[model samples]
Target: MTTMNLPIISSCSVDGCSYNHDHDCHAGAITVTDAAGAACGTYVDASDKGGVDASGRVGACHRSDCTHNDHLECTASGVEVGAGADRADCLTFAPA
Candidate 1:
């Protein structure tokens, strides 16, 4: 099988986000989309107590308007997750 070159989630500072592990994102990958701001569509509230054990990676993105997205994949080497208008957001997102 061919492997995909998904971007890694470098860091996340949203303490209440389920995918965050010691300031790092633990989801396999994340999708970024436009909400009130550049939001992390993969972000789940830790109150729900759900998350993956592996390090986070950027799988698919819906922000087709973002400059860093190509074919729904993030081209950035890495991404940062942090608080936004809603909750967790992709800090590397840039509008195209």
Candidate 2:
């Protein structure tokens, strides 16, 4: 299979998320969109104590309304994670 260069998660501040380890996202990739006011869309509740070994990349962006969204994938080189109504959010989202 052809390997795609996944987008790098520049930073994450969601301490309570399941994919967060040492303030970094461990998901294979992340999705961004408008939900609960600027949400990460990838945040998952952690039922365990530790995180996975994988680092998160920007996979699909549901915000077809965002300028950075191309074919549902994020075109941004990097994305910043921060606080939102749901705790984690993709800060790079911008309305198109």
Candidate 3:
């Protein structure tokens, strides 16, 4: 079986979301887009945020048909970010 490693959140995309620190994603849950570059409307937060060694990682690609959805984790190689209603960002994006 192909064992793929999950992506880690390095920063947040939402501006002033009370989870971003210098472009670093610190939110417990983050919003991401679909394979068609559309917003998935899924916000995932980390259980442990702003704490001692808090590993803030968001995984919301639960769709089985989704290419990025790898065992409930986003395996998409690269992701884009923007400041609009259609904007989307992946917290678990990694290069194939």
Candidate 4:
């Protein structure tokens, strides 16, 4: 997994959700889902601004051994985005 020194927001937008710990996204695998869970939030339109919404709509895997993961954040440079079967939800998720 690559390493990202980027600083993400201190809290998640999900209401009543408690996955963040001291501004560190420790959700293991953050899940990004629409209100209806119909599609992954990471699926960006090619025409979207900035290429994608790296902060608001992407998912990440915090698993210690995942090659594509890095401390709960995506280290693919500007591709802080990820896709998932459940609305781009974090596949390596863990309850707070």
lDDT of each: 0.79, 0.75, 0.45, 0.34
**Ranked candidates, highest lDDT first:** 1, 2, 3, 4
Model 3: per-residue lDDT, tens digit, 32-63? 54454334354334333352134344445544
- Assess candidate 3 and give its lDDT: 0.45
Candidate 3 Cα deviation (angstroms), residue 42: 7.0
The best candidate in terms of lDDT: 1
TM-score per model over all chains: 0.84, 0.80, 0.46, 0.25
Best by TM-score: 1
Instruction: Please report how far candidate 3 places residue 65 from its true position, in Å.
Output: 4.4
lDDT score at residue 27, model 1, on the 0-100 scale: 78
| Clashing residue pairs in candidate 4 (N, C-alpha, C atoms within 3 angstroms) | 29-90, 29-92, 30-90, 31-89, 31-90, 32-89
Q: Can you write out model 4's per-residue Cα lDDT over 38-87, one digit (the tens) per residue?
A: 23233332322332223332244344343444565544332222234432
What RMSD does each model have against the real structure?
Answer: 2.2, 2.5, 6.2, 12.4
lDDT of 2 by residue, 1-96 (tens): 111465678889877788888878888777776585557877887766454576678877787887877887777777878886667888777778
For model 3, the run of ten residues with the poorest summed lDDT = 43-52
State the displacement of the C-alpha of residue 96, model 4, in Å, after optimal TM-score superposition. 25
